[model samples]
Target: MDSLCPLTDAVIGDFAREDAAQLYTLVGRGARSHLKVLRNGLEISEMAVSDLPGNPNAVWTVKKNIEDQYDSYIIVSFVNATLALTIGDTVEEASDSGFLPTTPTLGCSMIGDDSLVQIYSEGIRHIRADKRINEWKAPPRRQIVRCAVNRRQVAVALSGGELVYFELDLNGTLNEFTERKLFNADIACMTFSEISEGELNSRFLALGTVDNAVRIISLDPNDMLMPLSTQNLPCPPESILLIDTPNDDGKGVAAVHLNIGLQNGCLFRNTVDNVTGAIMDTRTRYLGTRPVKLFKVQVQGRSAILCTSSRSWLLYHFQRRFHLTPLSYANLEYAASFCSNQCAEGVVAISASTLRIIAAEKLGVAFNVQSFEHRLTPRRIAVHPTKPCLVAIETDHAAYTEVTKTIKRNQMANDVEAMATDETEAELAREIAMNLREKKLDERVFGAPRAARGKWASAISLISATTGEKLTYFELPQDENAKCLALVQFSKHPDAVMVLVGCGVNEPLNPNTVTPEEAANRPVRGCVYTFHLSPTGDRFDFLHRTETPLPVGAIHDFRGMALVGFGRFLRMYDIGQKKLLAKCENKKKRYRERERKRKASES
Candidate 1:
């Protein structure tokens, strides 16, 4: 098993990074900035900062000499008001020798190896080696919110939630641009990454939106900015980082690490498919009640995570099976900023008045650390018959009962005082237990009619396929808990009927439990109800109901037989003959065992 290990710590400034032999930072206080240099975690020298042309509160990019072949420079702004500031021979050295007349008023900028692409508030511009190469104006009043760029292409996120892609010429000029929209949601942040190194490598754009969703768009020539997939988040995200990771075969970008920073000081870590950009798995880590910055690091030939949050910082060692081991944590007086090393096992973290070279090997383990975990649940989706429509049933509440069951099952085993709590919680637990007991009795009886039950309600809405209009709405009965919905489409019939599956223990089957014969004569809890859609499609008529052995979650028709998913099994029944045709156990235990084996092999 991998363990989290603490390496090093120091104090310095914000906006930091580690180079081959030293750490660099734009450090100072108040309105002044200084270039601070540190070697081996000790501050060596500090150079006074100089103001360049254009506004200082600007979006910028620092393209460092990662390969030691080219000099580092900071590119700021777009078009006419931008400038490039050259870094000196050392971290404490700064030069304004590469100043350019670039346009300002931009929200995002990308500095390439030898080029820069920026998105202005209303347009985009390209520059090559301190020279104005090209510029393109967007449609009137359509503000550009964010942007991501590579060597050959650029993606612009508009205020109206549309994304625009531009193909770049050999001279680093815009050749042409295309625009498309997905879900029409406001975008928060975006980052671009090439799947692998080389000319034929595929590129992907990860977009964070205000609607708490992240989408991956392919930048391949055949599908420029085409949305591959999306994952809905539990909270609104503020930033996104796409880290290229090595596969089992030591190939880069075989698995892409997507880090999404939520507004509530939580980070969502997802490993995504390199080509299709689908999320393979997900894990959550809570840092604090503030935003987090995620960085990828390699230590001792293994990948890791460096996260910085308000007033604290942590270094986590990434392990197999998406396990993150906390190596070390530090409390800071001020918000911490992180600068990562691409080719070394160290990072420059700055906060308050301290700067330190946090080496991976120097990290230490803290006892009793807990990881924030969440279940990546799948939603139920049902398609309408004859109509090109789909309904996504939100079922997050279904798991609550399962949790209550677990708590109740363990309550008797543990001490009474340990489980005792407020009166409301105690009452709630009792209620859940009663509900479960009644439901189990109803299923065991398997033969009685449904009785008048207390009120419970759900809604079904009809939406127009062409106009995106909500055409009609209907409320469900109060007596039952709705579990599933399906539309029966028979080609031989002129109209289709809607089927709803519900389960509720409205009445007990031999409440005394002593009379086994009376309990056996009662009907099951699961109910299959039918509704006839009116010709005008605005109303529905309750038709009939039938009892089922298990709480049906889904229904299908195959070869004129009703196939039902009743709890952990499937049953096929002949409606005309009113007899059971065949039944199959879902074998949930066997499936779980197989899944465990598969995961064990993967680890």
Candidate 2:
């Protein structure tokens, strides 16, 4: 991916490869105008256009034969000029660049006989291979927004909400055939359908407008630019396609199906009558979370519509039913368009920087996996109460080392301070330090050695629900390892949601020195931590911490109170007051019986 040469536009044509079409991309702008040729995702050649006077806007390629071999003539239109280059296989075969002066060029297309049609802000220009230029200006004050051309017909949309149709003659001249004025809405995108057999020109024009509606216009010679049918959409349409459906009798075309892509990541489909143009059997399906752009491509020797959004999806027919499936093999992001050229049974996708060609043997394999990398192993997860986010607790290999070190350090420091004043304290300090050393050796002999213990670092991450992107993260204290998480709202602050985390301390035990009764009498240590959500919803702000004598294994919100599990007991606390409300033994049957008797007495 070249940031210096960002891809602006691309076109596919049957240039030099007889087996597959080649891709030509226009990159850079103004003084940095350049062209790159690609086939099957490999760049074959690139040419810089320094002689051109303006920034390149679009590119078009036409195939011609020279010396009985096929050659491609590439034309790049700029703001005020056009550059033409002829090439065979490489840049070495490119002819001297030819320059044709013109008005500011918005777009250009090949219209047969080696003639090119260039559209400008005001009108159209017909430039021939002989360097002859013919001009046809539209009515005054009309500015062209978009233009689509076929073999013999052209459709130009204006900024002032008018669509003007044109007919091309054998002499390379454009004649204004008909025009229609849309009252209040401007056309966003428009395209001419493929020419059918026995028909000289394309028979229909599909227009998507800013008014959130799709209008199908008849382009037949009898009723040119006539509005056949219009369907309202939930959102503004981004792209539209017209596909001809076969008649039930196996004769000719029966109805034209319209596939519209909307701004809200949805595909709208319906069938239009070939004769009456009435729309029916409307349906819509969500493809992604971003705006959808539809493209026609050939997949597995069959026609399919590629919907490019957050993820690319292929819509095709299988077993007499239309199936919309995502392309599992190709993971494309920010894709502008796709074509079934240069790769066998695959697609060529153009994104912001590179052209990716994917060969998909099996189209939809149900592989939509997202992965997030973390240095520590995740132990617990909790979902946000009101937002589409998650809180995950992760810990390193030495999950308990931090707690043991903190306790040892504090005990040693306190004993040393008191030893200077009393001989008894000095004796206690030595005994405590010796006990710590013994515990360390026991851990090494029973489990991992001290050297194998990693530095303690526990962390929690906030993750997005939709895109799986990490939003924010915070590290826990050295003495704590996260055990459980919950989103709680206290009684005093019922409107505010807070994240609650329960943590436990880790310490080594020596079975050789301690009896079962001594082990059972050992104190369990833990803490409960709380945090508030930031205004932006991306970060967690530390609020308060509550220490517990027993290891906290679980936490839950019960009627605006925090129900915390501490080893064999359950305690309820009023978070706002920082006071314990109730305590109960870990016996469900006894608790339920007491609750039932209390309710009976109250009744």
Candidate 3:
């Protein structure tokens, strides 16, 4: 559940968004239709691409103009090989291949503040904001496959396994562009990265090839592009994201953190040496059953990966160390075929009638009880020392009877009965159908329990606070009812923490045979159980338990003393003395106005 989410898709062609909450999606096939999402829901407006000058049908790509932040312009590419800019309800034509003499085929495109770069079968062309055109011939008979632009630098991947690098000088002139043949196979995707202080002044070009390989190429301003390292993937790489450590002002980069998505639904994470571009460590995890649109996103302040697939949205826990762990996910009404602005908190996705804003914190996650079983309800939570998450102690409620397993098996049996039996056999057919309906109703009303599977207990769950992902769960024996919990970490024991759990009776021990008087007079023996949390924070080891005179409502460790709160009194027990020091009765009035707060004149 942490790694997969079912999502509703609106079957949009492409989408674009500037702010985290607003989105525009391309809908319809023959007639150009668009959907606008404003956080709450999607609005199918009566606007079409035909309202524009070019009357475009399919939208190939859509990107927001970064230079104009307030009232930003949206750069759009059409299947008709045209480029247009849109803002609000107004649309302006940037370029169209139909206007050209030969009707050149457009392969890839990039947008800038006042410029546009379109790659075609013949070569690459630059369209300035002033409408000036510049063209450069590509390698003989080779089409540009993928291209990425960052500021003045551009990296283009050609279908013939060659890479072309271009940089516009300060004088507004293109320098001698460099070409390097690196991959034996054609590159499917590539991204440009600028050098940082930690990289020793080395820039990079990361490429994912059609042959299931990722090549990190280091490019120096003076030297030719060279392959720094190559890693083979289990399937063809579909998407590549390079995450970097940011400095103040959120601009300077220090390290190379990379995430790669494969055609086989496998997502890989790696840390690369910023200078040499050599990969340091690699970790891979299966994200979904179908191909994924893997990209980084901020979900409720937690950095996560939104793996939008044909089925649902899979959000993974992303650490700066370049690792993808299961965080949380949601099931969709339909598969999200198109998505945009994948790095932010709000993601625009459309499928059929649903236009959804796939926000990380609001979407599905493992920590959300709704993602899994409902019997266990979280009682206590403790924040992790380093990670931005919480360690929760959850207790199971005994009131509900979960019918998970039996209902499933019974439904399968009913299916066999329905197939084997004939409708002419009215009694048998009706009986089987009735049983099936009853089984479904039972499951719907009463969910199954862990005790049915021969397991009984409470559990500790490590959950991401930002993304709401239940990372790991450690089940405890059901002997004790943990009412209140506290975690104490000593400086000497940096790797482990001491866990103190206060126990209370949640249910009667022998309610069936005991008389009413016997149950009423039963003693409430309180206990404080001690445990040692594992170094990895996944499991716990029981140490010992101490008995108390009265039932404990809450507990706190104050100056080496265990302060226990009860219903009528508060008790403080010193650990060194090994005995209770004092007990104080609760005061009806919490404050004495004159004694606590003095008037200004009296002072």
The lDDT for every candidate, in the order shown, is 0.50, 0.62, 0.51
Residue 410 of model 1, lDDT score? 54
User: For residue 57, what is the lDDT in candidate 2?
Assistant: 45
* Ranking, lDDT, top scorer first: 2, 3, 1
Please give each candidate's TM-score. Answer: 0.43, 0.55, 0.44
Model 2, residue 250: distance off in Å is: 12
lDDT tens digits by residue: candidate 3, 1-603: 222222211221111121122211212211111121222222111112233334332222233344532222233333344444433334445444222323333433334555656555567677666667788877677777677665456677777787787777655444446456656888887776544544332278788998888888767766557788888888898878676655435565455677787878777878888667787689877756666555444544544455544334444333333233232333232211122333233443333333333444433322322222323555555554543444555554442223433555577657756675556665676676677655444322454333422122455565543334556655554434556766655343455566666665433443376567754665445666666666664455666667765556787765554566755556664331232334444533344565566564477
Q: Give the per-residue lDDT digits (tens) of candidate 2, residues 1-603.
A: 443255544445533322334344444432233334343321111122123333354444433322213324545555566555554433232343223445555555566656666677777877667767787787787789877776577788888778888887776577887456463699987877777778778777888899888887888778878888888888898878776655435586645678888999898888877677677899989877888877665654555677777666777654555667765423344221222123234444444333344444433433332234443455556666566566666654454344555576667666665666568767777677666544454322254323223234466777654445668877776646677887888787887777888876542232266566645664347788888865445778777778887667899998888889876678787764453344444534467788999999999
lDDT (0-100) at residue 453 of candidate 3? 22
Q: Report the poorest 10 consecutive residues by lDDT, candidate 1.
A: 369-378
Deviating ranges (above 4 Å) for candidate 3: 1-66, 75-85, 89-113, 194-202, 247-253, 296-305, 311-345, 348-603
The deviation in Å at residue 11 for candidate 1 is: 24
RMSD of each: 23.6, 15.1, 20.8
Worst 10 residues of 2 by lDDT: 41-50
Best by TM-score: 2
